[model samples]
Target: MKILVLAIDRDDDFGVKAGVKGPVIGRDSCLDAAVKLSLADPEDSDANTLFAAIKLYDELKKKGEFDEVEVALITGHPNVGVESDLRLSKQLDEVLKKFPADGVIPVTDGAEDEQIFPIITSKVPIISTRRVVVKQSPGIETTWYIIVRYLKEMMSDPEVSKVVLGIPGLIVLLYGIAKIISIKYPPSAQIVSSTVTGVVMLIVGGYFFSKGFRLKPITSLVRIVSRGLITFIGVVTGFIVMLGGAINVYLTLESIAENMIGGIPTSELIAFLIYLNAFNKYFILGLGIMISGKIIQEYLRRDPHIWYYIASFLMLPAFWKVIDLMTIYSNPLIKKSPETLIAGVLLVLIDLTLSIIISIKLREEVKKWSSASS
Candidate 1:
C-alpha cells in the first residue's frame, strides 16, 4: 500500500481565464504552449514535478522496488481564496494520514527543500525526486525523447488539443442532452438514453480523465458502470419524489378546502402557519445541508471542488423555486393545506437528514476502509 502523490504544477492562467480550474488543463494558446513546454523538455516547474514522479514510479517498478505501490495525482487548494503551499501541504498531510499507506512521497520539482523536506519527514517516507532518473533504458532512450517531443507537438496543435481536451466537455454536453430527453420521456426511454449516454461518456471522457489522472488509471468499465448507476438512481429518485409530492399536494389541497368550508383546527393550523412563515429560512437551511453532503460526495467521487461549486450555484435558482412551491402549499394563512405542507416538509427533511447522515457515515467508512486497505 505504498503510495506516491505527484502534484503537477499545471497552473496556467488560461485555466483561470477560460474559467476552467481544478484537475483541468487549460485551453488558451499561451497555456497550451506552456503545457507543451512541460511535455517537451520538462522546463516548466509543474511539468518537471509531474515528470519526475512519473519517471520515478516507472523506474521503481522496473527495478521491482515498489511492487505493491499505488500512485495518484494530488491537487490541493482552499475552498475559497488562493491557497499557498503550506496550506496545500497540510491538506496533503491529512490525506496521507487518512490513507495510512506504507509511505507517502510528494514529487514537486521546485518546492523549497527546507519547506517540503520537514513536512515530508514529519509524515512518512519523503522522496523529493529532484534528480530522479525517470527513463534510462539504453535502447529506448532515443525513442522516448522522440515520443515526448511528438506528444508535445500534438498537445500544442489546436485540433489535436481540442480532440484531447473536448472529450470531457462533449461527454458533459451529451449527458445534459440525455438528461433533458429522459425527463421528457418514459422510464424505458430514460433508462435507455441515460445508459447509452453514460457508456459513451465513460468511454470518451474516461480516456481523457485517465490521462489527467495519469498516475492512477481507473478502469473504463468501472467508470461507465458507476455513471450509469448514478443516472439510474437519479432518475428513480426523481420519479419517487415527484409522485409522492403530487399525492401529498392533492391531499393537502383537499384538506385546505375542507378546513376553509369547515373550521381550521388550532394545532394543525398553527403548525402550518409556522412552517409557511419559516419556509424560506428552514428550506434554505435544509438545502444547505443537502448541498454540503453533495459537495462531500463529489469530492469523494474525485470531482473537483471548483466544478462542484459552479454546478451547485447554477442549480440554486431551481432549488429555490421548488422550496417556494413547497412553502406556498404548507402556508396555513394563505392556504389551509396543512397536510400537504406537512408531507412536503417531511419529504424534504427526510432527504436532507439522510444525505447528512450518509455523508458522515461514508467519511468514517472511507477512513477505515482506506486504512485497512493500505
Candidate 2:
C-alpha cells in the first residue's frame, strides 16, 4: 500500500512568509520548506507541523507498515476562506496526481488547517490525523496573549467590527449631540440625558431588529441610485415637495382644529377634507414627476416596465380629480354644482382611456423591438 502524509498550511504561511510555493513533495523538499519557514518566522506553528510530518514519514518507513510512504506539504492562500480552501484543493490534486496514495495521513497545526480533512477524504480515505500543538510557556501571560490576539482578529473582521465598534461610536456621537443641545437650551437641560439614553436604546434596538430581519434599506436605495442618477434626483425632489406640503398642513393644523370645535359631527370630516385638498395637488404633481423620471430611465435601458410607469403617471391626474370631488361633496358649506361633478367624472374617464391606449401602444413597440433583436 502507498500512503501519503499531508502537511497543511491553510493560511499560506509557507508562501507568504518563506516565499515558497505549494505541493512541496518528497522528504527532502518538506525539510527544506520547514527550514525556510522556521528561518522566516521561528514561532510559526506551521513550521512545527512540517517537522512533525517529516518525523511521521521516517517512522512509517522504518516500520515497513506500507510498501511506500511519502510526505508532502501543501500551502493555501492568505485570504483563509474560500480562496484558501480552493488553493489547497488544487495543490492536493497535484500531489495525488504525482503519487496516487491509497490513504492520507493529514498533519495540521490547528483547527483551521484541519478543516480541509473532508476535502482530502473525498479524494482519498483519511487513515489518520495528527494535530501539532506547539509547546508554549505556561503562565497568565500566554493566556492574555491568546485572548488579545483573538480580540484583535475579531475587530479586524468587518461583520464583527460593525457590532463591536459601531454601536459604541454611535452612542458617543448621540451623547455629544445631546450635550450640545442641552448647552444651547438650558431650560430643557434636565431632560436631555434621559432623552439621549432612550434615543440610544431605540436606535440600537432598531439596528438589531433590521439585522435579524435582513432588512437593508440603505443598500437597496444605493442600488436604485446606482441604476440612474436622474431617477435618484427625481425621487429626492419629489420627496422634498411632498414634505413641504405636509409642513404646510402642520402649520395650519391649529386653525383647522379651532374651526372644528363646537361644530357639527361633519366638522372633523370637513377639516380632514380641507387638509387633503391642500396636500393632494402637491402630492399628485410630485408623484407624477417621480414616475416620469422613472419612465425616462426605463426607456433608456429599454426595460419593459417603462409602460407601467407611463400608465401610473397618466393616472395621477385622475386621482387628483377624485380627491377634489370627494372634498366638494363631503362639506355641506360648499355649494353643490352639477356641472363641476360632471366635469370631474369626465376628466377621470378621459385619463383612464388615455392611459390604456398609451400602455397598449408602448407594449406593442417593445414587442417589435424584442423580435428584431432576436
Candidate 3:
C-alpha cells in the first residue's frame, strides 16, 4: 500500500508571500522550498509546515517504513476562503493521480490549515495529522508589536472586519437615519449622529471594498446561515398565526362582556363561553406547525439528532393540556362548569391525534425526501 505525507497551505501564503508555488512534489523539492522560506521570513508559519513535512519524509525514508511512500506539498488560492481550500483539494487530487496513495499523514501548523481536514479526508484516509508549533519568548515590546500588527491586519481584512464592525456600524447608521427622518428630535443631534455614522460606514465600506475584491469557508458559512434563516421564518410565521388567533380571542371576550350587559339568553351565554374556551385551538395548531417546521428542517438537513426533537415536540400538546387543567381548577369562572373540562379533554385528544397523523405524514415525506436527495 502506498502512503502519502501531505502538506497543506490553505491560504496560498507560501506562493503569494514566500514565492514558493505548488503542488511541490518529492522530498528534495519540498525541503528546498522550506529552507528558502525559513531563511526569507523566520516568523512565517508556512516555513515551519514545510520543515515538518520534509523531516517526516526523511525519517520515513531512512526507516524504510513502507515499500512505497510519497510526499507532496500543495498551496491554495490567495485571499479566498473555502474557494482557496477547494483549489488546494483539486491540486491534491491531480497530484494523487501522478503518485497515487492509499492514505495520508497530513502536516499542518495550526487550526487555519487544519480547517481543510474534511476536504483531505474525502480523498484519502488520514492515518494521523501532525501539527508543528513554534515556541517563542517575546519581550513586552514584541508582544505589543504583535498585538498592534494583528489589529492592523484585522482592520484590513474585510472578512474579519465585517464581524467586528458590521452590526455596530449598521445600528449607528439606522439610528442616525431615524433621527434625520424624525421632525420631533433636535436637528443638531441628528446631524451629529448622522455625520458620525456616515464616517464609520465609509471606513468600513472602504476596508471591505479593498479586501473583498481579492476573496469561500465564508461561502459555506453563508449557506448555513441562509438555511437557518429559512427555518426561522417558518417558526416566525407560526407565531404570527397564533398572534392573530390571540387578537380574535380578545375580540371574543369583548363580545361576551357586551352580551352579559345586554341580558342575552342562557343558551347563547353558554355558546359564547364554549367559543371563548375553544379559542386556544388556533394556538395549539400554531405550536404544532412550528414544531413540524423544526422537525422538517432537521430532517431535510439529515441531522441524526432530529429524533430527540421530534419525540419531545410530539408530546408537547399533551403536556400543555395537563398544565391547562391545573390552571382551570384555580380559576373560579370555569371551575363550576364541567363542560369546559370535557371540552379541554376532547381538544387535547384531538391535538394528539392530529400530531400523530402529521408525524406519520412527515415521516413518509422525509423518507421520500431522503430517497430523492440520495
lDDT against the true structure, per candidate, is 0.51, 0.86, 0.74
- Per residue, candidate 1 scores C-alpha lDDT tens digits across 212-323 of 7773354654664475554334444545555555455445644654454344435666545433433444344445445555554555665533243434534555465466
Best by lDDT: 2
Q: Which candidate gets the maximum TM-score versus the true structure?
A: 2
Cα TM-score of candidate 3: 0.40
Model 3 Cα lDDT, one tens digit per residue, 1-374: 78889888877877877798889899888888888777777887778878888888888888887878888899998765777987898889888998889889999876667778888889889988888776663243335546866898879998677767665777667775767666466657757676667876776676567567843436645775687765666677789988888777666765654443343324654544544454556677777777777777887779655655686687777866766675445433443468878887888888788777876776677677667878
For all predicted structures, in order, the TM-scores are 0.25, 0.49, 0.40
Relative to the true structure, candidate 1 has a C-alpha RMSD (angstroms) of 25.7
* Model 2 regions lying over 4 Å from their true place: 1-169, 176-202, 205-209, 253-268
Off by over 4 Å in 3: 137-374
Candidate 1 vs candidate 2, lDDT winner: 2
